[model samples]
Target: MSLLKKYCLLGAALWIACAAPAFSEYTALSTLLAETASKLEWNPLLESGVLVKDTTQVVFTVNVPWVIVNGSRRINVDAVRRQHGALVFPESTAKEIRAVLEQTDIPPKVFRVAAIVIDPGHGGKDSGASYVHTINGKSIRVSEKDIVLNLAKKLHVTLKARYPDKVILLTRENDTYIALEDRPYIANTIPVKPDDAIVYISLHANASMSSAAKGFEVWYLTPNYRRDLVTTASVGKEYSEIVTIMNDMKEEEFTRESVLLAGEIASQLESAIGAVTENRKIKEGEWLVVRKAKMPAVLVEVGFVSNLEEATRLMDDAYLQKIEKAIYNGVSHFIEQFEQSKGFTE
Candidate 1:
């Protein structure tokens, strides 16, 4: 039988045996546990007692209308009194206490990565790192915009197939130019609960004046670059100092997650194709994309377009597939770790 039902069956204990003037129905501490099975610990000298059942605990004192519940919530009830060296409370107070134990005091919050945003860098008028090279009398051209878009689409498809329950989105699905500032806006605008988190990953290809610089590099925002992430609407303008501190704390949380994500992707890249070229390793930067994003964010430079050897490899469909696979594995691993760790509190 349920605790509430059993307690209700013991209504005889709440019967008023004799009342001179007051019609109050009180139950004695000794009779409280009679014909019922919930545990009660009472201290007569201290005039205090505690009732415990399942996950609920109720603490009360003699001659007090207020009762401390679960050591946190203080609830008001009819005053408990010491009658003939025994503690007891009126019927109304008993009902109120019973109601408290049946409800409220839910479990702690849990964290989850519910949404992911993939931003393919540069498109349309702003063809990022445009390079024209001729290899063995054959004209070849490589655009960073096109390469990253292909990779982003592949990654999106793979992730969507893997996690159909989660939300996966792209800043620009077609070959359209998206402003740098607008990219992060897509990620920030995603509505999520306080315990829920979002991930923002921007894909790009690197370029240099010298053709020698070639490798895949993952970038995360530097910890030193503080973002102005506080919103005044949540709190009053007079609490600006407190708001700044709170914002700083929130910024640190996203930064930590971004670093973890960057590390995972960098390690996966090395594992994917370490023998072919450089992993370049995860670097710290004040990138606008990462800075503006209000969630965990990272930027990946898949390879260099300026280098003939790297550019030739980048043009290959199979090569881009390898890079895409590496990124997918990295993101998958990070999401697993993040969810399992419950936002990495320890």
Candidate 2:
């Protein structure tokens, strides 16, 4: 054999051997399992030792001290050594690591939400509901439109104070009526690039004829209803495919995170107001407000204005201030929770 030919054949064999192991290694790992692996250019700090996989859990050692698994269809990583066998990741460390990985263009193992839209339901001629009261011996009427506007303003201020650069928008800042459909339309119209993370929150006060229902309640759109309605409504229409595409996009954007966010907000609200109000629990509702929103959307019924006692409280300036504080605290708590879980900051 000639010298050049032999060298060429040897080089080809080496390439094949190297390629074979790369392919084999990934093949042995399930796609779902492999997804748990960090896409960040594997750093020495993150990959100094071998990752040992066992039947129930996976472990890493030395510089590669993080453990990861696909839990509940999401990638969960923990630093087993630092926690002294605990499962939680500290917020500061996680945020730093995530920022580093993100800068390097690594697809995040979990998604984090940043921007939010707040909608205060009802306004203008809508009047919503009216309640009369005698204040200092003069009759006064409290309108739902005004109450919600004030609440939305308070929420926007609180969110911006915490998030700063995070975009917080309101559907209506004044008593002017904004159509039900236009609320979600504003969310959909936001010029968000594919890489941006945003969510929507619509605030409303619930009313009941019994005047007995009162408390804080949070809501995420009912998925089954939104999907079915969009699908059915689009059938035989020119934009059927468009509707399918949009529905699919919305599902991808919202579904999982929306539920988590709703729960977090509800929990915080309950904590904030527990001393003074009833706990109405978190729930899912199929209202048009939630259903049509393009992002992970939730509608919060802060309390029922129907209950005479609650109505009186709602009309009180001091009570409204308390409600504002509670709602703001809930939203802030939710944002912090989301950032921590997804390992993001700001």
Candidate 3:
């Protein structure tokens, strides 16, 4: 062969040898790329081969045909299937990738609770009223103060048991006179952070001029004149204004929420006690106790002390237990609704 021909033949041989391995490497890379693409459910037509979209700041490479979740110091992806057909990811990598998924379109889980305060009405010198009833040929007198205190105690126990994690507090534990002004003050003064939630309920029994009329009723604070009836009688006009001002502040803070909370508790109590007693239905009232509480506050009149039958039941421990259960159910229902509305599952 001529020198030029020989040289050309040598060059051709070298080129073929180099091209063979290059073709093999390309074929292997193509297979890996296809597998990764199939696993990621990405469109094969849109992307192919190694793509470095950016290289200036943080490098984003599409070399392996897999999506990478970038973390502070590393990148992560779901592990490829193994010989045993097991699909898994490194714990750390899975966490990082999950975080990215959550940030992209999924919401993180959260939890919240509804705090509550319980107040049993009338203590110490305030013995409230009493009623005499003849049952089983025996006369029994049920004192309003004692009956209400026992009911409050039962309510606290029931609520605490039902919602162990939730915060529940009582204004007075024993027969002590907690000044009406100081009741709301204690509620408002609870050391709560900015994000804390709270609700309050004051318990009492109703009295009426007609002893014939009797049933259970719930009260939420309203600006009606009737609310003033209680405060006016309790405190003189001069002190009433101060009380009114203080109550206004509390109402402003909890007006909207108080209505909702009262409705919830009332519904539960009516359901529980109404089965045994006459259905009183939930009523709106401007009772002083409900009006003055700082947080979402309500006053629950379990039954009428004026009624002979209800006054008798009020003394029964078993009947009080039923009322306690109702109060617990109401509080639980309220908390559930509030948490759900806020998107807090826990």
- The residue ranges of model 1 lying beyond 4 angstroms of the native Cα positions read 1-106, 135-137, 235-241
lDDT of 1 at 9: 39
Residue-level lDDT tens digits of model 1 in 25-79: 8865544444234465443334455576654557677676777665446677888
lDDT of each: 0.77, 0.58, 0.56
- For 25-51, candidate 3 gives per-residue lDDT tens digits of 122222332333311211122221111
| TM-score versus the correct structure, for each prediction | 0.69, 0.62, 0.57
User: Lowest summed-lDDT stretch of 10 residues in model 2?
Assistant: 48-57
Per-residue CA lDDT of model 2 for 134-245, tens digit only, reads 5556777766777788888877887788778777899999989889999888887777644356778887777777767788888887655545424535333433323443
Best by TM-score: 1
Taking all chains together, the TM-score of candidate 1 against the true structure is: 0.69
Model 3 pairs in collision: none
Q: All candidates: CA RMSD in angstroms?
A: 13.7, 16.0, 23.3
CA error at residue 244 for candidate 1, angstroms? 1.9
